[model samples]
Target: MFKGKFRIVAVICFVLFGVMAYLSSQMSFGPRDKILPGIYVLNVKLSRMDRDQAIQAMKKMEASFKQARTIQYRELSWSLPMDQVGLRLNYEEEVERAMSFGRTGSLWQQFLERREAHRSVHLKPEIHLDANLLEKTVTAAAETIILPPRDAGLIINDNDTVEISPGREGRLVDINHLQQELIKSLLTDSRSPIPLKLVVAPPVRSTEEVSAMGINRLLAMYSTQFDPNKVNRAYNVSVAAAALDGLTVAPREVMSFNEVVGPRSTEAGYKTAPIIVNNELVDGLGGGVCQVSTTLYNAVLLANLEVVERTNHSMPITYVPIGRDATVVFDAIDFKFRNNTDYWLYIQSHVKGGTLVIKIFGNEQFKKDVVIRSWIEETYNPDTLVENDYSIRMGDRLIKQKGAQGYRVSAERVVMEKGQVVKVEKLPTSVYKARNQIISQGMAPPGDILSNPELPADDSPVNGEMEEAEER
Candidate 1:
């Protein structure tokens, strides 16, 4: 009787095991159009949904993830827009992942996991980020916080001298390593600020190198003064002087004054001041900048450099001698010179104590004794012009404008080397026109009213104009 009972129990157990195996195999190899239960991705429920339905769900969630991310370096932060960084979800990859849930494991394992009241299984979505976009974003962030390495430079000191400025090492974000970190962070699906790593880069030119460039000794120096009381004129002078300061000119290089200083509009920090217009003093922009060019021209002359192109004012300016002044216009007229020496030339300029000073520094080749002289060859006397004015009393005399005398002058530069005159150069002759003086005398009879007389057309020359002027 006991043997008979054991045989019956064994037969029942075999039958139940076969049934379980068949059920597991059917679930594993059967058509799987929907996701298994207890699966979560991006905190969205995707269970019991077809592949297309799951894809639609992921698309909706992706829109919410497109938000600005913050990147931090020390205490500074930069907001990186997600759209610009090319952040998106791979719908096909994610759907394939969810669809393969019950089909991956062994038959027995799938049976156990797919059973009711089983432990929850979490899934990772296939998120895609553009590699180039990642690099560009990090680079932009680095640019904001990184101070670029600057080469050593020169500065104009208060005491009318040149000084060398030290270069500084700069820091930049390690792009390759940062990219790995960014990818890992995106995998985490966390919305926290990412920290940045930096590396040091050396400067292109060091301070010691700049100082040893044979620009130590002063070659030639010249200075001219403007009225400090005239604030606009003083400002204009300072602007031009600063633009030319600490400039380096290579050997045989030609530099134009207008090209170096640029246009002198109000946008360039020039103000209206008394400038010679039509051979008469009038308020105009960039009035006192010519004084700076004149000073530089004299310094270049003393240094024995070659004058490439130069023009003189229509009327002689009081700041410099008749033939020593150099005038410049933005696009029409220009003053240019070449660095004829073998060594490079360094220009230093400054405005202090109502004086604009320009100094040229170079090697020993430029150090020489030099003298500049100008002699008046011809002088033209001004003519007297009388006009009747109804505003003044009868027989009353008033000088409308003080006359300016014009002249032609010749200039020469003498250079001495080793106690002997080595070179003599004659500059171009300058010719100026005479401006007639105007005396307003009341010529109307008493109690006699006259119609308003039309004023004569103004013949004043425009600033930065040499149309009617000539240099021979």
Candidate 2:
């Protein structure tokens, strides 16, 4: 009985020691005897661990604690915020590395709290100058500057009355400079509005006004005395006057005589008659009008104007010489001349001394001695008389016989220059009719002692001797 009890006690003790060893392994802490005194508590908790799973539970808790302790808190700057973007990746990597080491639970919690606090920190931005604003200021400073506008006008002096001149006080503006200033101002960003400048320039004058002065001087030098009231009866001065209204002769320009005078006719209030072709009397328009054109032609030549076109009359005109006369027929006939001088010309026409005269006023060079002359080339006979023959008796006897005839004619002209022969021109040709010639005779009685008183005395010679011979 003593041996049995001793063996039983040994077996019970063995069982109890095994159970205690297993329980110690399952717990979060190692054995009390093996652990150091005042050791830091990890505070790891495992709610669903089996009693036999204490060793495996302790190993898992140790891994988690180490991973948490390895995690670090990071602070970032707003200017260089790249850390924020990389923060999550860095945190995950640190956790994985720490987990490789052994630290558990409460340590992991403390590391997470530090990381959150760092993330919550706000970063401030640094102060710096704006490059765009600086560049704009630099450009504005380099722009061109301009002056303001001012008023100005012309001034005259009593001593300079004879010579009209421009005043020094007149405001003058440089157009090119003004344009540049305008462009610069428009491009500039100014706080105040800049008003446009007003520029004053010298008074503008036309070319015509200058030319008028020259024309006036020329007219004063060459103007001649002429009587408008003495104009010839043949020309209708009133019509010519009307056509000349508002007519101006430019320098070195030609004027057409026919074109200006137009057609002369009763409709135009012309009462004068003109000789026409065939010597036959005919009432027509512009009959005596050639006198006007002829007069103007002479005046133009005297003025030394260049003749562009000139046509002679088909027949002689009593009013003017052959070559000197100009005939116009509406759109068909025309006489034109050019002003050959540098000055302008003024034309004036009037009737004087039973003649129509045209005067041209210009420079003195044209007013020199000038003359025209003309004459007839041939004379034509007038119409001849016709005689008629008729028979009649004192008492039924033939008495006498009669007969008749007719004739016609023309003339030409010779133009002279300075008493020298210049040209021989034929004027309008004239045609005349022939006159009739007539004769009459009577019969004599048979010879029977009949004495014919109509016989000449020469035929009655020695009548006494012939009578004596016949008696024998």
Candidate 3:
């Protein structure tokens, strides 16, 4: 009776094992239209979902996860725009990958993988970012945090001299490492701001290295005054001068002012100021730039350099005498000069205390005397300007401008060494056009007629220009 009972129990156990094996084999070998019972893509559970369903699920959350990325550098942070990064999610690929899981290999192996998925095996989703955009975004932000090493520079003295500025080391961001941190954070779905990694950047050129560049002494220098109260014009003067400071021109190389100075646009750090257009003071971009060119032109002449090309303004300017000024209009009209010296020509410019100064330095002794001589062959006075307005008081006179007189002037540069005339070079003939002496006569009644009061003189260069005037 006992033997019979044991056989019944053994038979029942065998039947149960057979049923389990058949079910596991069918699960491993069957056609898979849906993901396995426990599959995940980048922590998104895709259990028992079809490829389309899994794709839709990922697409729903992609927008929320792919943006709001920020990079932090201590006190500063930059939130990268989604458009700039061009972040994209490849949901279809991830869905297909999830669908294929546990679908290949031997039956036993497939069964084991399907089982492992249930306990939580994480797979990363395919994420794409525009490489160029990512690099630009990271680089732009990194620049703010990075303190780049600086080369030795110059300090112009009040007496037309120079002092060497020392170079120094600085801290710079490790762009590659920072880029990696950003990528890793995004990939790992970590939304916290990433930190910056920095490295040491040593200065390349030292004060001693700058001294060896053949800049031994000041060859010549020139200065022009301006009205600092004209805020925009004053700001523009400083901008243009900054571009010219600590510049070097090779021996015999002709340097174009426009090319060296670059474009005179708002993008190039210039502000609107008073400029000469059609013999009238008008508002235009890069107004005070001509003052910079004119100042440098005088310095070049005093240095005994060669003038390649130059043009004068339509009307005589107040900063420099007639035939002494130089006007530039970017790509159209330019003021250029050749470094006629045997050594490198180093230039230093500064705008301070309502005065703009330009100095030229080289490895040569400056001439004992350099004079800009000018003679006016013909001259004519401006016509009287009359303005009648009802708004002003009667018998009251207001002089808008003192007015400018026209002239035909010829100029030359005379260089002397040890009391002996060494060289003389003729400059372009300047022709200035006449303007009107503007007077406003009021129509409103007044008790008495008053003398026309002239406008107060200011350092603002009303005659400075940014565009070419009629070939004057």
How many clashing residue pairs appear in each of the predictions shown? 3, 57, 2
Best of the two (2, 3) by lDDT: 3
Segments of candidate 1 deviating more than 4 angstroms: 1-150, 154-171, 176-180, 187-200, 206-213, 388-397, 449-472
Stretches of candidate 3 exceeding 4 Å from the true structure: 1-212, 250-253, 260-273, 283-286, 365-369, 380-405, 435-472
CA lDDT, every model vs. true structure: 0.76, 0.39, 0.77
Native RMSD of candidate 2 (Å): 41.4
Worst 10 residues of 2 by lDDT: 463-472
Residue-level lDDT of model 3, residues 1-472, one tens digit each, is 9999999999988876764575356453344688876678767788778778888888865776666677788888888775577677788778887887776777556556777775766778766667677767766766776677898876656675667788988887665676567667866878888887778888888877777666767888899888788888888889989999978998789999998888888899888877777777677888888989999999988888889998888877767777898988888889999987667778888888899989888876543478999889799888987878555678767775667778999999888888889888788899888877877678766754344444332222344432222221
Q: Could you give candidate 1's per-residue lDDT for residues 274-343 as a string of tens digits?
A: 6665566666788888888888999999888899998888787666767899887678778899998877
- Which candidate number has the best TM-score? 1
Give the per-residue Cα lDDT of candidate 2 at 181: 41
In model 3, which range of ten residues has the least summed lDDT?
A: 463-472
Clash pairs detected, candidate 3: 227-459, 394-444
Model 2 bad stretches (over 4 Å): 1-213, 216-235, 264-272, 321-323, 351-355, 375-472
Q: Per-residue lDDT of 70-140 in model 2, one digit per residue for the tens?
A: 11112211121112111112222322322222123454443343233223311111112233442233223
